[model samples]
Target chain A: MPLPMTSNQVLDREFLEIRAKILDLAASFDRLDRADGSVVGDPRQSLVQEALSVLSSTQKDRAEQIQLLFSHHYEDDWQEKFNLPSAAKLRTRST
Target chain B: MYYFDPHIHMVSRTTDDYEMLAKMGCVGLSEPAFWAGFDRGSAESFRDYFRQLTEVEPKRAAQYGIQHYTWLCINAKEAENVSLSREVIAIIPDFLDCHNVLGIGEIGLNKNTKNEAIIFTEHLELAVRYNQQILIHTPHLEDKYQGTRMILDMLCDDSRIDRGRVLVDHVEEHTVRHVLDEGFWAGMTLYPTTKCTPQRACDIIEMYGSERLMANSAGDWGPSKPTAIPDLILEMRRRGHPESLIRKIVYENPLEFFRQSQGFTFKSPDADDASTINDRTASEPK
Candidate 1:
């Protein structure tokens, strides 16, 4: 049980601020990782998301950065988008 | 009048099954590659199973003029050994091209253990990779409840799976609502001793109304007869079930489910046979 006011306000405030930054980074990276991030319909991404969710925030942020860096080389989240319907143009070339 | 049995383990059954089912009006049957009532240790055992469902058994079925198709994979209870299960899974695609190999399953939780869950997810991945439908086996006896919960939980985890493309098999009264509520296909098995009988399966149909549902005989090394499904069809007719109602459970429902896997269409027999879903004699073998 967390005491009503036992934790330091400064530390709590700092945690919230860091968490916000982390989420923002995650959201943007999510977009870059998927050109169709609007639909996040790729189940493997859901697989990856579920896998990454188990990690701590620091690890998650690092993983997001890796995803962002790799995905920057392409126009879309090609890794997850390859077999899906939206990436039909890119899909034909790979085959 | 034709009937489709969604589940029959014909490997352990005999020539009598064919002669018996043919006379009873069983035009089409779907055999799920269930465990042969025991764990198969080697990749070779599963390979032979693949051959039987894909090659040997269908030939035997065709000779009887019964159209046979199969769901190919290791059974859930055996899938508890994740390593052996994966070995069985890897060999599946090789046999999938064989005649009547339709889907990668009878996959789900047997005892709902962690090992079973991992193997269940692997089966889901195979289904997505091949763009195939899945047939799930919800466990029996003591493990039934936990197995159903575990199967649904893993299924919900993967968005690649269309819940409608999965048939949760071996459903009894307690398990039907959970199977139906998830938007997946609900399957009832009619076995004389361990599982629900045909009479009970018909009772379930009466109570639930037969949409998104089907029934079968999971007859195997266990003392069950594959003709039980045809009996259920007859029981439905005896009680004044509409011809349309019997057709939905015995023919249309299973036909649609198997059709999701490419090239598994039912080419109805041109001959006069008792297997017609609406045939009054469909349940009695001459």
Candidate 2:
């Protein structure tokens, strides 16, 4: 039988995947930056802006996925066990 | 390495540009009617423009041993003036039979406005009625995504329109996949400022294998380069892409798409098998 993965292993894998995706996104941005620097105006600006918008949305979605994964893996008494602030407390503190 | 610039506005260009394009291996090009940097006053202005495209430009290109083809339509910017657009559309048939005239185009949304859509549909109707090919211009900058979506929706709704015969020009990275996925040809305009640069165009080619895709300079009166395709050639070479792949995108693809037009009887310089060369002068209209 296959051994069950520990929470750390699952989290590590997810982090690796997310990190790789971020690196890929950064590479795309770098390539766009390295493109012909002679072009200056709405056309070049719009192309870069649109690409960034797509990458930003993708990054946000990945972040949400990571948050969901963390929430799913958390113990029922995680807040108390970890001594983390409650949502209500965090909201108050943020305000 | 011969290349075909499937979409460019040569009316705004001087004869010197023609000589330069010929020197750079641009054997043929298509000039789609567009805004003359400003809205023309009347339909008569369009008539004169069409005459210049059909009569003057071809003769000038011929001097440099280049073939010239053209598309006719009141550009979307001027299509806002519906009454004038209709008048212009009415006179388009007079020039349809001209030897070098290809079809009706450079027609699509400008601002993604209602009037533009109305005029766009009318141009579609004319194209449908006459069985002409279409070349489209999606809007610029902030309006590009919405305008492209609107144009795609309009095109999709019309079942009579052959998606293959239509080419959506000025496509950027965001909009290009949607165009190609929907079974339509896409054109990447390589401009010095405002459209896809040579490197960016090469990147697009890498992302989307060039099937129905081609590139053009859109060499108009604005700040644009007429030799942009050659720059793309250089970029493709620098990236180590094979000559065949580059030729397919720059030369063969446009030829394949344009071959659908009855008026595009292009004879490549290499088709110089003796009998065919001799027959050319004999077939010239007396």
Candidate 3:
């Protein structure tokens, strides 16, 4: 696994600024996926899915990512709020 | 004796299909949302249709001891009507929570239209977002050869999707090799006309053997019968097909299919149908 961004890596301020910009781009890509539906299918969604997967591994760095990568979906946790049907509905039923 | 139909259309079929199918040892069926004969005017049409599929019908099937599952999506062939399909596909995720829906699917290219391809890609996106398996529909008749090829090509070209996560349904001699060779699951339809017959399908089983292969009855408004799968199995048994091969083609194949899918878990088998014997009447299920 890649090492997490330390206080110095992010505290450099210049790199944090760049990470913030990338996170903004990620947020924009996520919005495009929401509005266009096709965006989530774009090859870029693979990158985002990967980045999101990686963000789960580290702690303090993960917190920084929570602020960086997910401006809307993370901040809102809207997937839960949206009230999708219960997972059981999709379950295979008794014959 | 556990039979599974990975592709079926419940809109045109009746409750008796569940009863008869259950009695015939058909324990479960996956109903793909599709063009049910004519076109609809609004998103509300699809809403009501989804309601009937996920709510009204499954309860009816459960009453008869058959498990009814659904693949939710806008039909691909009608995706020529892209504007409406987009509207319908847009709302499909809202209905995903209904206990019977398996995924946003039975979606793919038809007429090989750019607009249809766009919709197909979007549906793929939805599956990825929701983490669900895809049930793709390859066009029929004249469109079969080229359309199936086109759908698989798009899936391959799209790096975000995996071949194993999709079911490229409605295979014939022309497309079965490519579908299986590509490592995607292949589904065969047993329509009396337009699709393969039981004898021919069994012959395909003999030739292709089995890997990621399943057979279904896309019984719809046409003269097609819902008993197509049963006929294929019956013919296979009559022609000296080993019981294991029949189980592999029908029961094991589909069961393993849903089992591999994301967020999908097995529903209990209808444990209460002790009264219904496996001896089914010869009449067709309407």
Candidate 4:
């Protein structure tokens, strides 16, 4: 019996929750920066920074872009490695 | 508002959960074979699990008026044990004829290991030999993208596979486009955390449109919500999407994919009920 709500109504209903999540994320970053040692040039930190930059992008497909950014690069012979009977070790990436 | 959950692990759930599902207008669901939280010891264990899928779970779901369909496989985690995995695969055909048994699935890469890939290919061969639909589970978290890539590559490489009959589940923004572009059905799993949320699913629906797409709770033993499909419906409704569009994604789309399987024979609950007799059915305008 309920009618479909408008987009503004949806945003109004979700605004506080979204704001709280943003604050939580900001607080976590603040806590991280306040810690003793710095993760300045660490690849993981760089990935996070890249992900944040993706979040600020104007692209409509930012989600896909960010997901691809965090994903493994396509290897032409990716399946060939599976031919080895032995279990694979995790592939370490420098970039 | 009737819906079908295309992928959920009801064996890990309770009768109370079934009651809740039926109460939420979930008329049907399909349970794909997956890891039982730990590595099952042997092929005999998989046989027992298959029996539960084909026999026990169907009766249990029937108690709540939910039509339960299932898939058969050793699951990717246990596929690490090649000897036991082969043993289990040999015995899977024994239950393929079970009325509730749909096909081979939740069969995919857990850690993207070589052993997992070998076993996944073997499962595909089995499904192809028997002419069954496939339900795939891509890896989670960090491994998701690569695992999905590997899965799609393998599936596409197999010329025996009919992409329309296959469902690649747990697809996200980066992976879903490829899955759909390759002509396979895609399922977005709605989890409370970790996997896709209702909001993200709504976005996917908006971007992808309703064709060959569906959503499921993926409610398993872990931190999952069994009523997540209804939650998706609520989210879709909240976004001002039409009821028809919402119903297509949550209900009709799943039915379209599931009907391709020889084992899927779903009876509408509305057929006997006086409720919504005036409403048009999903498939035919009556």
Candidate 5:
């Protein structure tokens, strides 16, 4: 059987993954901004928008996954103690 | 070369786009009510929007000799506001009898949230209650597969929905088979990006065959080409696909579907010509 990973190792891996995604998302935004400045109009803008949506969605999914992981591994009362609002509450407030 | 764009958003397009579409042999198009680039403040805003769709847009399209038909709904993005969506849904019936109105549509999941699902079903209920045809907007990207499955499942659960009269738009390769196999009409949106391009759409046609399938530009407020359907035509012709098959996807198929709507009274421009009578008789099987 494989050895269990230390929490720091897990955090490092996750942070690396998230950092890469953030860079990708930033690159996508940059491409969109460049496309906006160009004269190609519809096609370029659309291509960049599609790329941005995909990257942004990936970023959101990763963030959510990390949140779930953190919630599971941390103490049960950790959220209440930290005054961190529940996911449902956050969604309601935003909406 | 005459065609019909089964789905488009003329409300977001300028009059110049209408002229260009008409020039490119577009005889008619249907605009499904969707988000106006931002969340609307109230049901009254939707009321005015519907008025513009039913009243002003047709006149605009008429100037270019293009017939404009519309489908009404609170699009899934804004449907997250359940109380506002309910208010908007309540007002949809007011426009159903309008001459240019087609049915309740462009209604489906956005984020596939619980509230969105609730409003989707409520919209379905309204469509069923009124015997209206439906046009669905499946979510984009990663959400598309799951959202489409949920929409299809909900549709399957409701026997009242005639799968034939409903169209599930924005289908990609992964989801098209399911939509078609389930007996609902499918629409492939030809976009510059983010959706199927002309080449990909042609490939889909080759794989799926043309029965109960169509394509649209989905020209709206975003970065979209209103004339993307012509690009598909060119691509199909370049591939040596027969003109008849091309005509079926762009024209006859849309006619066949839109004919189900009581409000659709489209007459072909060639209806008065004697030479096309035989052509019409031959293609009527579609």
Candidate 6:
């Protein structure tokens, strides 16, 4: 899994791209803040805020942490929540 | 540059799509069984589908000088029917002897539903018993992260499963790292929408480096381009990546993973008789 480019080389190549993304994110947050209605009580918004915090953290596994933040927790009876049929009903007769 | 698309659904595509793929340097491709635009009624439907994958598609691909390999499974979206899923699983072994049959997959969770998990595990058991290589489809968009986690957990729980033989495909920036860290091959899918674009895929290649990583178009009956691997090659070249590195990701990596499957006997486009397709059966397709 050796990279073709050195760390400094990659950083030099992608620096602007990274900076632009951060700026874009900041602008998005600003836009959200400027909107009339608030999403303060929304779980998705909270997750987004938490993800931003994770990105700012000193930990090396920020991607993994953020992924888990948005993931569904394992549930044993998740099928009970959905009214999906246990057996498939024929949708179309193959021509 | 010659490349292999490790995952695509050619059953939903036309001969023109195959010609376009061959024209654009797709030397070979693998089509994992996928949802047929709708739920199929019986196990007989899957049997017919398997026949098409093993019999018809290869000849169709051969006409355009493209080698077609395939995986067999009842896709996750259809796996909600636990009874039908079991029926499909039972009949899968009947086609495993086919020359082009790669393994059991494109099988993974859709909504991370319990029924999907049950059927996913059942497919795993079938793969282990038969010693077939696996190709997985992690869920799309919003469900990807969670579904990928569940798929990984299921694979890890089975000690009989060989991590090296399994390919967890459709990985994005968020899930790619974990798939590679766990010693399984990762596939990034290129699409016009929903999955990674060529630019994003190239960025991933830079960040992750290419060991057990590869890319595919996943082009099916959707808003996708079958020529996407070439686009990835073009992107890599544009980013100043060496031809050798680009080839490793697009060509060598897929061959390496596929070599583990007993069914894969691919001849490179550079070979003397590369135009000649192997594994052609004298008996007509059933």
TM-score of chain B of each: 0.91, 0.95, 0.91, 0.95, 0.95, 0.96
Model 5: what TM-score?
A: 0.73
Return whichever of 1 and 2 wins on lDDT.
Answer: 2
Worst 10 residues of 6 chain B by lDDT: B275-284
Q: Taking the true A–B contacts (Cα pairs closer than 8 Å), what share appears in each candidate?
A: 0.00, 0.00, 0.00, 0.34, 0.00, 0.19
For residues B1-286, what per-residue lDDT tens digits would candidate 2 score against the true structure?
9999998888888879988998999989999999988788989999999999998878777767778899999999998899999999999999999998779899998876667877888898899889999999988755676677778877876787899999999986667888999999999998764557787688779878989999999998887899999999999999899999999999999999999987898889777552212333333452
2 or 3, greater by DockQ:
2
Q: How close is candidate 6 to the true structure, as a TM-score?
A: 0.77
What is the C-alpha local distance difference test score of candidate 5? Answer: 0.80
**CAPRI quality level assigned to candidate 6 from its DockQ score:** incorrect
Model 5 C-alpha lDDT per residue in residues B160-258, reported as the tens digit of each score: 789999999998766788899999999999776456778767767876899999999999998789999999999999978999999999999999999
Interface RMSD of each: 21.7, 19.5, 23.3, 8.4, 13.6, 8.7
Worst 10 residues of 4 chain B by lDDT: B277-286
TM-score of chain A of 6: 0.50
Each model's TM-score for chain A is 0.27, 0.30, 0.32, 0.42, 0.29, 0.50
Go through the candidates in order and give each one's C-alpha lDDT.
0.71, 0.80, 0.70, 0.82, 0.80, 0.81
Q: lDDT tens digits, residues B1-286, model 4?
A: 9999999999999989988998999989999999999888778988899999998888777767788999999888888899999999999999999998889998999888888888998898899889999999999766888889888888887777899999999998788998999999999998765567787788778778899999999999998999999999998898689999998998899888889888988887768774422222222321
Residue B261's C-alpha lDDT in candidate 5? Answer: 94
Q: Which candidate is the best by DockQ?
A: 4
Q: What tens digits encode model 1's per-residue C-alpha lDDT throughout A1-95?
A: 86566468756646534443443445434334433335358786566567667332333234224323322122223223323222233235557
TM-score of each: 0.70, 0.75, 0.69, 0.80, 0.73, 0.77
By lDDT: ranked, best first: 4, 6, 5, 2, 1, 3
DockQ (0 to 1) for model 5: 0.03
Which pairs clash inside model 5?
Answer: none
**DockQ for each model:** 0.01, 0.02, 0.01, 0.16, 0.03, 0.10
State the lDDT of candidate 1 residue by residue for B1-286, as single tens digits. Answer: 5788888888888878887888887888888878776777798988887887877776677667777888878777888787898888898888776667778778876655667666777777788888888888887654665567656756765666788789999886556777788899999887765556676677667667888999888778876877887788788888788999898898889888888888485676764753523333233352
Model 2: per-residue Cα lDDT over A24-62, one tens digit each: 344355455555673447696567667767454324233
